[model samples]
Target: MKNITCLLASILLAIVVQAQELKLKPRKADALGGTAFAHSISDSTLSLVAREEIIFREIKNGNVPSFLRKFQKIVSKATIDNKDYELVFFVLPDYLAIGHNDDYFYMPMTPILAQKVANLLHCSLPTRKITDLIDQNATLKLTPQPIPPSKAMTTVPVFITHNDLVKQQMQPYLSQHANGALTVGNKKDIVISNKIYGETTPRVVIYGWHQLDGKPIQPLYNKHTNTWADYSHGVRLVQNTMWLNGKKTTLAKILADPLLSQLLSDEGIIEKSYYPVFDNY
Candidate 1:
């Protein structure tokens, strides 16, 4: 009887642990989502600094792409410390974008804003190990299209251009995913790592713009300042919730654990796995 009861409980726990979904907080009524807001800014003559501020504010107040609300679940299982472990977690189906309804554009921001958005949505950036896992398991893999780097890469015009390019790339997939799907390889991801823990000046760590061959173009690099956001950068949020060995856990907690940290981190224990969110980076 005891063994039978344990088996039933295990089955019930497995059912509950599968593919959890996370929804973003509700936006205010009549408030603009990511759609009208991004288009308006592209046509305006606002300075780059001004545009970034408003973009951050709009996102903070919940003006994000509607598709972002439906977080996609990803599961990873592995053996660490001579024990098998399974991790199930939720992530944004698409890279963070700004829009409402069916209209939206993927937006890139500095690590400062990325961390702030993660905090707002109760999500965190991915580690290198998880970044690779997402790419490997994503349903759609878009070829990365990197615009030539220039000073204007940080400008709104480039952002709009990149958005159009990405939309064009997605046209063939629209029949399958009208709004979005679990996608990867289109842009370099803003990631969390122990690399930033001791940097003299705060730096943004980016990785993973994989090719059709499944090889990444960028490496785990942190030379860029947290304030330097380019057109190629993307923010994909991973929900803080993590299921470890069929029990409720979090990235911060598991990452701090020496043994379980092997599941998601390539750099060993990442006790501090996120950037410090701040007004000035």
Candidate 2:
């Protein structure tokens, strides 16, 4: 009985020693942004040092494309509950953007880049379990309605072509218009490009023509720092004002005319004397 008691005491001492040794180490913070840390899970500890070092090495080795590197920015870093985390933002060439919070990483890339990152990290991507829960709990009803007769509709195609061609087309109207007036297509393209380049003060992305559910939507990228605004409404309101009795006008004519600019300024879409500010950081 004394031998049995000794053996149990030894086992307990060993367990206590192991528990004391299991500790998390603070990792080096990235200069651009991101704090490195060791995460303890069950019997194993995962180090971000290995993952981060690999990324930097690959980048230095020129493994990542130059275009992708241009949009990569370390937005911020923070320490929470004795653990450090970094928020890195990336705007891909394909217009797929990603950002992260402490609890979750949000990526519009969905299956493509998200899967690739998951593979690199040797982790599985998280599914929308909350969405599943909502669907399971909620009652959905489907009702059939009478189908209306389809009417023949004539659609006018809008073209965004060469700059020279656009300038040439607008020459007739240019003499009457202001110097800085831009066509509808030009305005839309510039704003979308600005979002991708992180030029916007509170980054905003304009959906491609009829991209989201056949309707255009402008969504803010930096939701944490920026308030959600309906930019789509402002864009549509300006476009409607430019239209003459719902008839589409030529790009050159629109650019050459001061009426569009006046209307846009009046509607608060564009400032009276607007200047584009480029963000260097």
Candidate 3:
């Protein structure tokens, strides 16, 4: 009876742990953002960054294995510290799991996996207390703490802003999340595109983000200024605006194009966002 009870408790704990899902937000290739821990930099971040460099080197070395060869387009170069750099680091495993409602990929935080990642990248481990960032994030302010001397390994989330593939994954949730509705904060006008509504015409749906008391975020539009501002720039939306091909196109226009629309509406992409990502069974 004692053994059985212990087993049952263990199973229950596993179930609870498995129930936690990691969600990533949508980010475009050109989207700009940073993810530095308040305390000291974590080992996972260094490992991830170093691994990225290795991946770049592999492609450059021209001895990339067959499996990696197939990913030539993605494994092209390493420009992390460069300007034309388009990818933004979103999540670093030490405190949180930053992902999107769409099909965002996650890197597991197992001891062996984490250690191997560090070894392969030749980076030092992030000190302890890195996981304590949750305390600071609760206040939604920057107050990073350094990791102390400890042997415990931690998993945290890092958001990497890069590529349309990631943005598509983040779309359904960012634009129309069911549980947590998107609330626009302060701003003059909110310009929505057909991309969010699955339409075409370069049409701009302008809306206001500011509200008094309990009033809802209202929509605003004007024909005079081609600029459809919303949520006072960064304060409103959590991520950077999608600048498709460096051209600031409207939402309606993107929807109008059959090619763009089809890419956005791919069944494989949509299903991943709708269903549980890690549920392979």
Candidate 4:
């Protein structure tokens, strides 16, 4: 009896360790600004749908005539049993665009991708469970509706600072906008990009998401400091913002910044701008 108790404890410990070690880094955002992430039932989880394709220029002209048929077979095999992974094809004309009956990552149904996925899953046996879950629970588990900007009175300011690596990453997007303005109601926001000023110069961007709208809206990210005013019901409110290095706290601090709270209460931007002074180490 004691040996059995010890064995049970060991099994419990193993499960605890496995749960602690589970981690996933979301895939970088796709062209549409959507990042791919996932949750799983076990360590042995397999991707349900994956998009695999060869570019035309990557293949010989004559190869397309023969390779096209092979591509069809690959898709057919991939879709069987509602393969769980999703594949997005950029190819035009005959590109298999979406999934058919598969439990794909993004919940919304894209007919092209969906039909292709259905075709592929029609042949696989192992993926049937995912397909069945998708059929039964899809309505509940599919993509969540976005929250409207007006209702999101609680604005979270995420200030990314002191990271040369991250600034280098955002340069491309900033160059495109170059102070281009995006307006939400009476408020107009600008996009700023830079290559220099690693210290204290934090870039900022705002994302307005709507729960009922899944449209991709541009989100601003920056390293240097910037400011904006909040006006509601014909009143102007002001706020000074800064970065707090605590890993997951940026989102909350921005919304509740003292300056923002005061501005909203006062009904206007501050007559005197307050710089969030940070001490250097």
Candidate 5:
């Protein structure tokens, strides 16, 4: 009995140590953005549509916050069919934000705009498995902040309010990762799902917003139209190019691979990786 107890303790200790050793470094995205675009959410006359245009314009001109320029390296290791594989990818340290670091607002956009921004930045949206991998390896995690449902949920004021709430939740760690480190939780990700394939109706698929204990508040869902976006929704850009088994490859190739797609997608393969672009946004 004593020998069995000792063996169980040893296994527990190993698991604890492995969890404690999880850490990641920022991959410098110096060329991404440094120009600061200062915008105020207090503008009541500006409609959400107008605000979205301004957000896109600034980002297109490379006027995003300095912190977002830092991509964090996320590594995932898996063993399938008795073969070991490791995939390394980089992601923006946090959700896509607008304006200066001190005055930024986490911008929520329709899937159309999200796709446009992703294309402009040479980035891609995360999959369900990718979201889980990122959350599991995130340097810091926070509780999800959800506002009461209302028409204003898609407005800028509510968006700023939720952003501020998230800031408060992450306040204690601000000093260590001033510009917003690789963080998980706080917003539901606009992800690529297999459901989007061959659907006659355009829809938005979202997942994530994990709690501190790593349980996700939102499950894989696509009930909303593609153009619908709310304060709780956030867009995270993943670097298109990733390292697959030590060889640099594109997410396009990896996601379309027969077996390798499992690393980044839970629901089989993601053939239609992006939402159809709408110019009206």
Candidate 6:
């Protein structure tokens, strides 16, 4: 009696374990994002209960070779809306079977997915070289070599100005980002430097130009001069401007320049501050 009771318990445990194995089924049209009905199967018995439209004969007959079968549960083909589609299943292993819902089996990964599943199954997956993997009709193109770094810069120049105070304030900022050497000289003196310039044209930043007492200069028509005087020059203390690439430009314009944009980005400037203005240009 004791031996018989032990045998019965073992059988019951086996039945419980088998029942725990995952079974995936088709999701209805409403849930499939209007694509098509889908289903998954790991056993031949699935054919008996699966819908008639889900073609299962290929999987049930073991048409797919063992090597391919080790990765994914066999693939079954179906026709919906006159379009052909493939259905694949996920099989839970015997050791730790778990229940899964329909969505879990909807879309499986491509080539690499099979390899991952094979690894989980503790099976040896065959490897194919790139030459073997490429189809006869497919062509592989090599990437073109990049332009030499030496030719990245196009022009170089030395800045000579009378505003020593403003120059002193901007020197550190310019020196840090200058791909070429930063040369400063008096209005009458010439400073020469042997520094390689990058592809971008460099600029000089001038402050408090076309205005008296270093005040913020606005673009206004001077009636006496009868010309657009202050409009071309001046940087305000609160509303500052800079000479970008040798042109007197506003901060908005400086951020728009592509090379300056990259430079500002490299200097740890946040993108959101300038991205909106840059997008328009």
How would you encode candidate 4's per-residue C-alpha lDDT over 1-281 as one tens digit per residue? 97898687657544532332101122222311111111221122321122111111111111111111111101111222443322111111111111111111112211122222223322111111112221222111112222334522212111111112222433554432222211112111221112112346532322222122323233333332332311110010111111121111211232244443221112222221222222210
lDDT against the true structure, each candidate: 0.79, 0.23, 0.26, 0.21, 0.75, 0.22
Judging by lDDT against the true structure, name the best candidate. Answer: 1
Could you tell me the TM-score of candidate 1?
Answer: 0.88
Q: Model 4's lDDT to the true fold?
A: 0.21
TM-score of every model versus the real structure: 0.88, 0.17, 0.18, 0.16, 0.82, 0.15
Question: For model 2, how does the per-residue alpha-carbon lDDT over 102-155 read when each residue is reduced to its tens digit?
Answer: 211101211222223333322222111211121222122111111122221100
Error of 4 at 37 (Å): 15
Model 6 lDDT tens row, 209-247: 112221222211112111111111211100112233222
- Tens digits of lDDT, candidate 3, 1-281: 97898687657544533332222222344321222211122345555344334323322333211111110000011232342322111112222112223322222232222223333332212211111111222211121112232233122222222222233443544533323322222122222232223333222333332333323243333332222211121111111111243333322333344444332222112211110111111
Q: How does candidate 2 score on lDDT? A: 0.23
The residue pairs found clashing in candidate 6 are 152-199, 153-198, 153-199
After superposing candidate 3 on the true structure, give the runs of residues whose Cα lies further than 4 Å from its correct spot: 1-185, 188-191, 195-203, 220-235, 238-281
Give the lDDT of residue 255 in candidate 3.
30
Instruction: Report lDDT (Cα) of residue 198, candidate 4.
Output: 39
Measured with C-alpha atoms, the lDDT of residue 235 in candidate 6 is 10
